[model samples]
Target: MSKALRRTFVAATSLLALLAGASPALPTQGTFLAPIAEHHHDSSLMYGTSSNWSGYAATGGKFTSVSAEWVQPTVTCTKTDTWSAFWIGLDGDGSRTVEQIGTEADCSGGTPVYGSWYEMYPAYPAYFNNAVHPGDHFTASVTTTGNGVFNLTLRNVTRNWSRSIAKSLKSATLASAEVIAEAPSSSTGVLPLADFGTVGFTNAKVNGKSLGASNPSVIDMATKDGVTKATTSGITDGTAFSVTWKHS
Candidate 1:
């Protein structure tokens, strides 16, 4: 071939090779970063309202009253690309009391069991101060997982309340709010289940979210917006409850 023809052929081949390298690669299955799962629960009878309780246990002591509220969303994902956060709203009557508001990744085993959980004390006086009371409002967040589950549980433990007090309290009412993200786990790469649950209180309502049984990639206890605390009051019990996972 002539020198000019040879040069043109070489240039064409080089351009083709460059194009091949520059082309975007196809996204692999399970390789894409899924959106953070979101869920919310709200009270149907009352707008942001719930029941309460007070009690005592052999281990804790001096139990008073306990109330709670929560929300669960309907989104699913294997893991989050970013960190997860939770938000909540709280209120009550009587003296300013300390409330323990927390989120857990795996709670299928029950409370105080330490089954891969993350928690936060949103009350005004820290656990160290030991001075929290009713009518308190605050927000909390938990990024760590107990074992590696994507489950989130919000429990409002009173400073002086135990399982006994949780049972005797009357005229108890309260509200709980929550939010979560699709953030990646620090301990492991897998995300926790999106299912969630709450203890104490009556007439609970979960809003701004949906169920996860229909989604294949999403897990239970995964919330995105955290909890909200508005129009809440009263108390009934101190028992623990949860939104159990149902995979089809």
Candidate 2:
């Protein structure tokens, strides 16, 4: 096999080995990054609301690929630490695992912090070493061969940098695909959401078709007490939409 293909094969096999005996949260650079999904999500509410996620997710069918592009929103910070993420993935809408990658805007100790990360859910996210500032244009995608091998790719167009990881998840359900703006969680529960104003996403696609073609569910972030946090705009032209933040 050629060198590049050999590398991909090795990466895929290595991922299977990791997942076969995965830990709750793996240490990265001797530190654990918090997980992002709400484990107890009520998927029964397909077009329902979530406490931490706002965007579009298409379920009820097997998905092989998902992609979207967005401009990273800048966070307005306060004394409270808060976190927000924007991403595209193939699961975790109705299943346990999510293979996703995206950009992050956070308020760390009341200061603005920006970066990017990818997570194979059930494991802590592995952060990319590159810095991603606000306004960076990012295009990301997750694709699987419908058997196991998967590819996750992200590009910071404004920064002229890209990353692609070949991974394997033999037990992945591929239950759903989505592009989301989320309030990331810690060991406790959903953390405080950063004030990101708004993020615009375009060129959304699922399995090579426009995501709107799947009749995706539009989500709004809210609390069980009926407090709205962020809202998703209906997809326009089958490819574009926006999420506007409304709370902390």
Candidate 3:
């Protein structure tokens, strides 16, 4: 298979696992941090009305799984002048839930990057969050662990874009990145539980012959599940999750 095809396959398979409530174990080679809540002051900047949530399962004090994916679009003026952007959200509603706090960005002069995370909270209504920033070339992941109201964690990854731009591009790079919510945070924030809801993505792409114009889809709660597992797909490749929560 071609490189693009391979990437699509891998991304799709990974997203499937997340939606099924079955997440793989973390890598032991790389150092990892315990899950923590990362809150953002700018919540309204990413808010919208057309958002939906999915992948709800029950986990009693044990670790439940969630994941997201999406594709991002890159604008190329010259082979040497190019840029891209993508975003996603992490949220939940209840007395305590998981929330996304921040993200990291990575990129290449010509290629893309990846990002991921694992978040944890002590209360419900975590709020909508993203794993990456706009105009970045990166991919991300998230995970969480804990019991009832305590002992939750979050992990994140953000791909950074390069400053160099290829001059005289042969083809336009328009695509959707994948965003996954591997683990929900356990928090007491009001945003996670509000009626407004949350959103995420999996992939986005543009044809070499056509202009790319697509917006990232939102993920929100359809049914209230007590500590349920959910998944979001169809996002810009390399984008992560961000957050904007309201206190009610």
Candidate 4:
């Protein structure tokens, strides 16, 4: 075989081998790098708002991958020491674990701090060495390469920095996939949410298809009582979408 064909054969065989193996043991806690341990507030509402999350989720099937492209929003911290994250991932919808990667646009001491990160939920998030700035175009993804194994990739297209991680988690069910903007959780509770103005996610896809083709669930973030935090624009051209922040 030619070199390229040989490599393809080896990769295909490896994937098949992995899928045929027994599932790995679940981790003690979800693995997402963050300042403190906090619950991820999620949503399934198609059109509305919430205090926690605003994005698209594809449910009702065993999803293998999720990805999105977005230009990082310029954040103005109306309040100090606030937090928010924009990310794409698999699981964490109806499952106990999440494999997610995204960026943070936060306020520290009333100043804006921008950075990138990846998490396997319940675990604190880990930051990337690459510098992040407002208006940087980013592309991120989470893929389940096989049973209990995942790959997370994040790229700062504007800055030309990228990171990829692969690991195994037996607890992951690959039940759902998402692209979201959130008020990060903390040990005390959900942290103070930052005022991130507006965030737009474009070219969203699931299992290598446009979001619309996957029949995704539209979610609007809100408080526990259903007070809207942010509103999502309907998917355009089957792939592009936007989220407008309302209250912090």
Alpha-carbon shift of residue 212 in model 2 (angstroms)? 0.4
**Cα RMSD, each candidate:** 24.3, 10.9, 19.3, 13.6
lDDT of 2: 0.76
Q: Identify the superior model by TM-score, candidate 2 or candidate 4.
A: 2
1-248: candidate 1 lDDT, tens digit per residue: 02211000000000000011111221111111111111122212111211111111010112222223433222332333211222222212121211223322222122111111122212111111122222222223211121212122333343332211111112212222222222222223323333322222223222222211111011122222322211112222322223333220
Q: What is the lDDT of candidate 3?
A: 0.24
Off by over 4 Å in 1: 1-100, 103-112, 115-159, 162-184, 192-242
Comparing 2 with 3 on lDDT, the higher-scoring candidate is 2
lDDT of 4 by residue, 118-222 (tens): 777655456665777889999998898658888999998888889999878888878877888877754444556677888889889999999888776666666
Runs off by more than 4 Å, candidate 2: 1-35, 38-46
TM-score-best of 1 and 3: 3
- lDDT score at residue 108, model 3, on the 0-100 scale: 28
Worst 10 residues of 1 by lDDT: 7-16
Task: List the global CA lDDT of all models.
Answer: 0.21, 0.76, 0.24, 0.68
Residue 11 of model 3, lDDT score: 8
Best by TM-score: 2
RMSD of 1: 24.3
